[model samples]
Target: MIVGTAGHIDHGKTALLEALTGQAGDQRREERERGMTIDLGYRYAALTPGAPLTGFIDVPGHERFIHNMLAGAQGIDLVLLVVAADDGVMPQTREHLAIVELLGIARALVVISKCDRVEPQRVQEVQTQVSVLLAAGPYAGAAPFMVSSVTGEGIEPLRRALLAAQSEVSQRSREGGFRLAIDRAFAVAGAGIVVTGTALDGRVQLGDTLLLGKAGKPVRVRGLHAQNQPATEAHAGQRVALNISAERLQLEQVHRGDWLLAEWLHAPTQRLDIELQLLASELRAFEHFSPVHVHLGTQDVTARVALLQGEQLLPGARMFAQLLTNAPLQAVHGDRLVLRDQRAQRTLGGGRVLDPFAPARQRRSEARLAQLQALASADSLEQALPALLACDDGGLDPQRLERQFNRLRSSWQLPANAQVIATRQGPLLFTREHWQALQNSVLEGLARFHTQEPDQLGPDRDRLRRFVALALERPAFISLVDELLAANRMSSSGPWLHLPEHRIRLSDADALLWSQLQPLLVDGAFDPPWVRDLAKALSVDEAEVRVLLRKLGRLGQVHQVVRDLFYPEATIRQMAAMLLQLASDDPVVQVAAFRDVLGIGRKRSVQILEYFDRIGLTRRVGDRRQIRADNALAQSPGQ
Candidate 1:
């Protein structure tokens, strides 16, 4: 089990660890010279001959080095909150306790160090202050003890208390996959790279290949040490140093905050939708898009909070928000994250990650906010999954789900009726009922479109996707469309989708409208009028002209020059051949050359040239254009 020491700088936090473990935590010369820990330090202690070892993470207590402290705070089974008796409770002492509270560390023991410096009454006064502070916060169960590294006072009792707490600390379930949040990394003489941290979730043995992140290079564990002794295997809840083979990997690639994963889950994500808990100490309300520093398991990243439900998050208030980070983080559900000021000076607040891979769109809906709240309240994967899928109607990415919950890969179960949509990104899950609803929605949309035009093919994929209220990623939506076509529930032609029974039909009214609109469009081919202008020329309402032209365009009778402009397909093809021939001959088809070849005025020539570029018939470069025959083939009708 891991025990992290927290207190003010120069307050004997490192000294207390050294005295208990019989080794100095600060191994660096600078740390020894300054007499303070500037980074994370590790030491180990064995309470008895046969008892398991207790590892201590000695974190810097200085306000300037709080970021370093936070890195060592993750995965701590118990907290040894040290306060120097001479100084009582200092600023960093209070801040570190706040951090411990925010991180949700359940077990703690406040040690009033330097009992030798002050008299017995002075030590008693400091203990009272510490106890009073703990009583007011989440760490109220903590008991304070007075100790001195110089005199060894109360040291045995402290060890005994920690051992008792160890018995009560829960064991990490081995049911989940392996993941280690690296807190330290360095190169050794023979070893390529060594990363140290507490193993979480699953077991890893010698020669087991692990991934540094989702997309990181594969790393082979040459060896491992548990509590400073050689060990063939390491599992969740144990502190370990994995000797990574230098022959296979460069030391520079591994860094603190990178995870040594089982290669089953993808690398961490930068964005997360979380339930942010603001500190009551902060006076200013947390505003939307507010810039801050996010500290998670030794990783420090610049991020901004995008409030999901409100414009401002008041102090001490909990709100659902999205944290957009400048760098990626490997995290899962229940990972505690602290938010600090952008300057990295003050702790603004903290929060728990509700969904590491939150939907990037439509997160503000009332249903979504309610779902996030449920997720925040859920204590286990079994309780969270259904609530999550209930709000995310489009579907949840399976890889993201794996990253969000440690129990998901094994014991955590999903709904019996759920189905998977395989996409390039990952598998998306939807309940059978939801999938049926989606299929019905698609069919109804197509039926509606068919009834409106009757002379046109069904709506294209993009148009069909717009009918769904939820915004799904493009690949997942495409996968669903493909599934429907494969199942014979829908039919597809090119990029369009329709029910199998759907077909284009023309009524007498539509035929008359087409007869009136066709000649006018084809005659105005060289300088086709905009839709509104065409309606004016034909002595008809623009809406009527729009309906006729929509049918005409879908029937392959005309080309949409742009949104409002329409031209006959025949006119467009003739122009395409002219442009291609000019580029093929000269290699540089300029506007002047195009104008000369088409024999149209400058304005019409510019419009037509841009139109060709927009339609991918020609590529533009330095006032010139080149046509790639392959990509340009499908863009031009009749090509």
Candidate 2:
């Protein structure tokens, strides 16, 4: 079970956790002298005697470092809210309670610490104040106790209360994808760079390559330790210390905001969607589009809020809003957040993240606002997937999708042809239908180009690339085109592409000229005849003969042997089949015999044989031709 300590500054939070766990939480020298925590500190406790697995997260109580406190509170199972008996329910105490409430922490035991400093009557008065405060927050009706780490007055009762809380806590499983928010980074003498944090989900072993967010750099785990002892693997709900093998990383290079992830997750974005609520005690004069400090998962960003409902919100009222940040942040859906007013620098309220990577939208658009609200309320992946798909404008990045649905990816059951492709700009999600439509459009574009330019073989690759890029305007356009070719819907020759289903239909005059050109192709030469010669021989116009040659080239029915000469499809196919069959029987056939067998001169035979090699029909030995073992002719037709 995992436990968390929460209270205002200098309220004996770290002291109580230390006394209960036998571990000192304050690592920095300043925190020990100042008597206030400035950063998050972690320690472990064993509620059950000789138990193997039990821990607690000791969080800072300072209002300024509440962002650090939030990072520690994300994966906690039980709360040990330490309230001093002398000063009950202070400002930071109320803010921390609001954060826990927004984060959905249900079970808690309120500890009124430092009871020895106050008189008995004063302690009772503080208890009454604490009870009133708890009645209105998430800790309403929770059990309250008094404890003092100095005198050990109520330690036994507090221990019993913690043990009872441990019994009611459930175990956390490590079945999802790994996500470790790095709160501390340092270097060990012998071991390389080391990072310590609590694993949010899934497990990490001693040797696993992990991708850090935004940077996307791969780092290997050299070792793992849990509770100061070497361990093979660390799972969710366990505080972990990892020794990384990256030598170039400095201690200051990695900060409290980076994430160590299992797979490449989403790129950090500057805008987000959230369901915000204002605290009842906050002033109602705060406007709707006010600037505030946004805190989530150890990241603090400055953002302006735009309310989804009325012009201004009343205290204790909930409303949907968008946060436009000043910088990028690494966040995910369902993460809790705290918003503090910028002018006064006081925490206004808190809320849960709905869309951590949303795009900016204009205000006063009712339809889009309603859509965002629906996305926030979606309870399952089935509901969320379709809503995300509808909002995706065809250019959602694959890495972002993997992170957002890492836990539910297996359940999505995307088809084989469906793919998430990444390009230089971003990622795009495509299904079989989208690929088919793209192929059809490319084929039609090629056909149009062939009709207009009779001299060219086909549309060049640049033309096709540009056409698709302009038509789709998606970041994954190049990747999608590559997928289309891999699936055999399109084929490439030289620098041109052709759709497998597109064929060139010929007119009567062109058919006549094609018949005349077929016999002359047997005698391949650099310059055969001009268009006028072909027209004079076939009794047709020169323009018609030119059109015939162009049509044949586009359909792969003919290839330009030289500047003016052309070879017909029938001659090429017959020679290709003979060469394939001969190479299959004799592993080594001389180049001279290959030329003689095809009934063509050396030049044309070499070109046709090289083409066969490229099509995977044959292999080239030392100055000879040999058939590939896995060639199409080597397999039976049924295959």
TM-score of each: 0.76, 0.65
For residues 241-329, what per-residue lDDT tens digits would candidate 1 score against the true structure?
Answer: 99987345677778888888877765568779888988887889989999999988767899999999889989888888999999888
CA lDDT, every prediction?
0.80, 0.70
Worst 10 residues of 1 by lDDT: 629-638
Clashes of 2: 0
lDDT of 2 by residue, 1-639 (tens): 667888898888888887787778656898878778877777766766876556777888887777778878876778888899888778888878877777778788888899999999988887888889889877787767888898887888887777877777765657557778777888889876888777777789988888764676778888998755689998877778888766566666677767787764535777777888888887674577889988776567788987777778789988888788887776666667888778535778878777676656553465457556656777544466555544443544445655554554554655455656666566566665655666677667766765676555555454565654444653344455566678886665433566655445677766766777665654443224555676677677777666677667766666554434455654555555666566667767676777777565787667656765664556787767776543323333121
User: Deviation in angstroms for 237 in model 2?
Assistant: 1.1
lDDT of 2 at 443: 65
Instruction: Provide the clashing-pair count of each candidate structure.
Output: 4, 0
The segments of candidate 2 whose C-alpha lies over 4 angstroms from its true place after superposition are 285-289, 306-314, 360-371, 379-383, 386-400, 411-639
lDDT of 2 at 432: 51
C-alpha displacement of 464 in model 2, angstroms? 16
Clashing pairs in model 2, backbone N/Cα/C closer than 3 A: none
Model 2 TM-score? 0.65
Report the C-alpha displacement of residue 194, candidate 1, in angstroms.
2.2
